[model samples]
Target: MQQACTGDRFFTFYLLDGFALHGFSAAVEALRLANDVAGRPVYDWLAVTADGQPAVSSCGMRIAADRSLAEERDRLLRVAPPRCIVVCGGRMAPPPDRALEAWLRLCGRNRLALGSFASGLYPLARAGLTDGRRCAVHWEHFPDFSERFFTAKARQTAFEIDGSLYTCAGGNAPFDLFLRLIEADLGTDTVNRICEIALRERLRETGERQRLPLQARLGTDNAFLIRVIEQMEANLSEPLRLTALSPASGLSRRQMERLFRREMGRTPARYYLDLRLERAHLLLLTASQPIIEIAMACGFSTASHFSRTYRERYGCTPQQTRLAETARRRAGGRGNAPEMEHERHVA
Candidate 1:
């Protein structure tokens, strides 16, 4: 153990019930490693919960808290507050606690820096701290988060740092976020040492991709096929005819169809139809647009046609899908039900 640095920073991690273990561990471990390598306590931290008791993680592991939100609130005017406060979020977090929301608002009024790990953005957004700010959440939660909180800009990147707000897509991404903070506070040399000790090959910068690329995901290097898919994705509202795509792809219509069959295991037209349907499905779940407007946005000739095709593909009508999503939300399930059909057309 090393002595404390003159300018030691204090961090408080508020563990919501069922918090993500990987994100919490990654963040705390990064700070711990920084202290070990610096030969001084450059950072100090304490785990906190809503009540003065241990909180269970999503994986069923438990972490004891040093204090409760009530205790901290009572001492708010007496002791200096931590420099940063982080909320550890998970899939199974219970309904938003009003007490927690109030505390977050108090933190915001004090102008203290705040952060969220994984799905913690939900609570932060509910507390109105993330309004109009870009934040990162796990990709699985992106659609639901966007639908619920229209004011916050939900990005799909690995992490985001907008002034006093910090957010990271949960998992190992927090390690990268903590490294960035360490670099800013201590320097690149200390960050490098921490990364080396943690066996991290490289530090992913903010705004870098969190998900795999299309080519890597599909295990193919077909440039023409990739370009055609890109075109389909870009022209969702105005689908291009095969003839129009042929000239752009440098392949004749027949050649493109044959290539789509070989690479995607489906004909070009069928693949394109599935692509549009997937976009429509996402819009139905995440946007409040009317069904007819969604149909037009997805290039459907009419709302009935869109609903018919959606039923055939998803085993439910578009209205039904929307209803199911609403029911799931009302029931407190934060994620969409698994798609009945595997999305083979996703680029």
Candidate 2:
């Protein structure tokens, strides 16, 4: 890591087509505000693209790059390289071009720190940069990312910093990340001033959770029920028997069943089964794992049983769901697989 200095640090943002506009604005705006308040250039940034042409954002805004990938690559060989390079991507970002992927590999070889925002992590992961690293990805993309990159550790946090690699779940998360970076490079006073100028009420720490708690989302105050559901979520790969949950919840089997029936309108066993099946469904759509492996991961004793339960709930076989997802990706449309919409949390 480079020592924090009073001199300006250069940053390069690689914007991909369909990149989130808010994420780009938040990052650059923070640095812009920091320089404004300091009355000097504490940070410098350049926007770049693969071919040096304008990139279109998800919201249909066009952004012109300051340079092309080739130009930046040549410049890196001649001058002091950027302190950091961040890839900003959109929801439907396509797989990176081979030229861009090779350029990222060159950056890695030069020991330049790299980072990503939103679905930009997808390209980094595809380029093998995120392997064995903890990355924060939007909840909407977690399933697909996990399925595609089994070796990478994905977290549902606001942002993550592993070594020189930084990533965030997108939206205003880039603001939090950039603020933290500004604080580390300058000081808390500068960060606070920038936040005030930006009209932010509070600066969210990187450790703050990105997802709302399930209890709050469900609008329930039943602590016991919440605990039971948490346990079930934690034990999805190896479901607990109803009798075993008694000790964990400090409630008898009958009591737990009654609570589940009253609160969720389902038996405890049925609810647990549904949880596992739902997990399996997500794995089917998001990951390329085999049906049998997904079945085992979901704690089903056999693939037949998993398929039977899946068919009953979703009215389609797991293979059919995977195929549909594959077709959707090929067609450039949102996948046909059903998502647990309520489970999603904004970045």
Candidate 3:
């Protein structure tokens, strides 16, 4: 159904528990600037929580709700409901919300432009709204999201839009998505002005990578070394042999070994092991996949070997990492998880 004689395009943002304040604020500010530049309210929005109370962000900030999910569902029956209903999410994977899922199903049938970003996309994907649609989630949560939502064609890009559904990976990625919305409704000129007002350098186009380039990350301009690392990331699950990786760099094993030690401060084998362990660490904290599965996914042939090696490097078993994260979340995601720094230090 078409919007009922709506002068301004309206949006209803249903902010989930522990939603990312950065992305949510970016979206609101983008619309506010669009109205400022256009000399009128080209867009209108309302922020709501699950139960009509203020939402707590991942960083522990409280955002007041304009309405509740129940209220928003009732409003959908009235004339000119929001042109889009965006779900804001945070670092935590959302638990099952039957009400939200059912409401999302209704949104899909209503032909409303549904939107979500970060871990928030879980509900849309879980609700079956993203079936056969392209979607993106934050890189930190990508492993879990991809494993869980096979029906949704998941991408590691900044954002994805298939017909009326728009999904973004978390952080500043959603800023680009919201700017594209403004450009669609207003024009390129309006979007440019909005970016200027927001002090944004430029709008990141869709399909751009959610992660920094390998060159930037490694802080090295050695093309051969970078190529080797690229292959390592691409083949994390099965893992490429050092002999095979040497061919990627056109170097003898000894030459490549020196390169790894010089640049990364670790032997090639140690570096490869660390890379795989880093991925496992992330999966352990953010996902609930079984230990054996996680071990295999990270190229560990056995869970015992994975556990022993994990303990040697991180000073705890994989089980401990997951348990600590669960404890932190139960504590309402307040302070950082003790093992979080270990993962962050991964090169």
Candidate 4:
């Protein structure tokens, strides 16, 4: 239905148990700034939760909602409903939550816009909101998401908007998405003024790439190690064997191990194992693949061996790790899981 008026666009951000504080704050601040810049409320926004309780964020912060899911529905209906609803901060592979699923179905029927931040896209995908729509998701989760939902076009964009659906890569993309919203509804001038007030850099256009180049993040001068790690990362599924890596750099396997340890402080095998694990971890979180399937993709010959190695490295079995990840998100903690830190961040 067409809006009865074209005044303030209403937005409701639904917070699952464990949402990211940074992403949520970014969305709120962007809207706040846009409203300030416009010299009027361009957006009428509200944060809501399942039970009218405080939802904890991944950054150890808690947000008190304006209303519970039930109470907010009436106001949401009255306030032009939601032109768009962005869901952020939750487990990537959440099992069916009937109440939450029902609400999303209603939104789908009403054509209220939909979106997600970071791994939050998992639930939306599970709820079947993203079918037949191009979506954007954080790059870390891209592999499993691609492998499972082969048909969905998942881009490495800061954000993607396909008709009423909107998605922003988690981290800082929320800032960009809201700025775009401001520019779309209010004007560009309002967005600029808010950017100035917030002391933030000007928003990157939607087409700009989301993540910085790897060499920059690593802060490394060792060209060889960087090259080798890059190759390993790019081929996690069909990773180069130790013998294969030898020829890639014209170095003996022993020489490669020595170089990796000298520069990266880990053996080549350990580093490679970690790389595969990181990819597996992301897929486990974002895609609905069975553990066996994910294990095979990450180069594990058997699920048992994969579980054992994952436990040894991550201090938890693969199933334990997955469960902990899901629980942490549900508990609203932004706990860091094992990532393929090809550089200094990997342990």
Candidate 5:
């Protein structure tokens, strides 16, 4: 990590198409408040886009950029560079942008800190910037991120700070990440005041899991049942048999069956099948992995079996889902995948 600098820390926000506005806002707001709380500009930031024009947000809002990638690169050459460069992304990962990838690599060569949110991490991963680095990926996108970037140590945590790289899961997770960064820069006293001003209840540390526990998500506090679900999630690629799961849950096979049916309103086998199908559905919509490969990854023996099961669960085949998503992207509903508004940075 670079030595922490005092005075002002300048940041550049590289906004990608279909970027999540909330994540970007959360980060900037933290720094904005830091300045207010400190009675000076402790932190400063600017927005940048590929064309130096306004960038559109995921929710259809537009934010004007302060400069273009080329302009920023020129500034990096002629002037002091930003303290950090952040990539902001939305729900879907856009297509690769060659120009953006080069810019990010340049940042790395310059030893500048790099940051990203949600699918924005894709660009960093593709540019080889996140290789062997710890990254925090939103749980909804964790499967695709990990599958595509095996070298990056992807975690389902709120955020991760590994060396010069910073990553945050999408949504409100950015608030926690930015707060930590602020705390690092200004100290605990200032952070506490900032939180009070923002009406934030507490500070969340690193290594916090991104998702709710299965027990909470399912509206049940049964420890044994939750343990079995965790096991199921961990072994999705090669499902465990009821006999194996029964021992782990401390219930006989028959007892497990009764418990699942009563609490979940489904047989244990049925519940397990649904879990696999749910994972398969998300991958089908968001990933480019071949149907057969997805089926195998989800533990189906054959593509035919996988397609049949998928159709029953989703009311459409995997191919159909892929086609629809393609059409949607082409129609500009999704602004096409992975575009950085022509500069092609991560996200």
Candidate 6:
């Protein structure tokens, strides 16, 4: 029986339509690296869709799968049940197939581990798998996920691994999650080897932040300044004036000004303008909007003002930044290309 078996650990990747292409790709590539570096196949990955059809990603790319859920059920019965199942996709709930849910329930009962990436948390929540377990979700979707499922403990972290439930913040965190998994199941030596082949910097430990660092995020150290920065980020498309933020934060304008100068090393108005410029930079890269449109969207009074400030902070005009990002995305690939390379270098 042992001789007939092909590999030890079966990793079933459930590819839901509108799955995040980057998240799934990062996971598969990480596993591939682990296998190659280990000098033996430690994991066997099989992509599966509901009806054995190919799956499409939210980014409009299509990927073929190895089997259907039904066929997988038969295979599981014949061999060892899958040791791990990874759900990958967007905001949609898990397919409302009762049989599939039942299969997962049985797998869980039998001690199989499970994980979800990005908005894939929706289905896991829908299947009642995350109830009572702490899960990490993409920050953008946390509000909606929390509202929809009150039974689970969801947070904006890089990843959460509680017992058999593993959830990662979407985007690049899958690489970290899979690397951590390799280190947990195989060994640290294997993870380091995989990292070398994948060209990834050392796998970010779970202790590292899932988001930008606090100092970089706020661009300052003052508590009040940080709060104002948070407020600006919370309302990027619709920014607030110094006067408005002062009243909202219960600080007089003079006090706010003093706090900003002491902590952020800049006036509130300048800080807020930089924030707007940052938003404009992101829009310019990801959206195909005109510079004027982006300027207006980010609350610039006029395109000329937006362009001047953008150039000062970014060392290039908004159009130039967008062009550079576009070129990088084309050369490498969509998704993993650094979103704030220009600004990071400038700052």
Candidate 6: which pairs clash?
A: none
The residue pairs in collision within model 2 are 147-287
lDDT value for model 5 = 0.84
Model 6 Cα lDDT, one tens digit per residue, 1-347: 01122455767888776678788888878877777777777776777788876676665566766778888777877877776888886533333567667767766776889898876677677778999988997765654466577899988888888899989877888899888888988898888888777787767766445778666766666566666677887776567767899877778999998888877789888888887776677666544557887788777878898899899998998888878866644443345633222100000
Clash count, one per candidate: 0, 1, 0, 4, 9, 0
User: Per-residue alpha-carbon lDDT of model 2 for 111-150, expressed as tens digits?
Assistant: 9999998888887888888999989988756756876788
In candidate 4, residue 138 scores what lDDT?
Answer: 75
Show the lowest summed lDDT stretch of 10 residues, model 1.
Answer: 338-347
TM-score of each: 0.73, 0.76, 0.90, 0.79, 0.90, 0.66
Query: Across residues 14-115, which tens digit of lDDT does each residue of candidate 3 receive?
Result: 888878889988887787788889998677777777888777777666776767888778878876678899999988788899999999999889888999
lDDT of 4 by residue, 301-337 (tens): 8999888888787787777777776676554454554
RMSD of 3: 6.3
Candidate models: Cα lDDT each: 0.80, 0.80, 0.83, 0.73, 0.84, 0.73
- Candidate 3 global lDDT: 0.83
Ordered from best to worst TM-score, the candidate numbers read 3, 5, 4, 2, 1, 6
When 2 and 5 are scored with lDDT, the better candidate is 5
**Candidates 2 and 6: which is better by lDDT?**
2
**C-alpha displacement of 124 in model 1, angstroms?**
1.3
Clash count, candidate 3: 0
How far is 14's C-alpha from truth in model 3 (Å)?
1.6
TM-score of model number 5: 0.90
Q: Which candidate number has the best TM-score?
A: 3
Question: In candidate 5, how many clashes are counted?
Answer: 9
lDDT score for residue 228 of model 5: 87
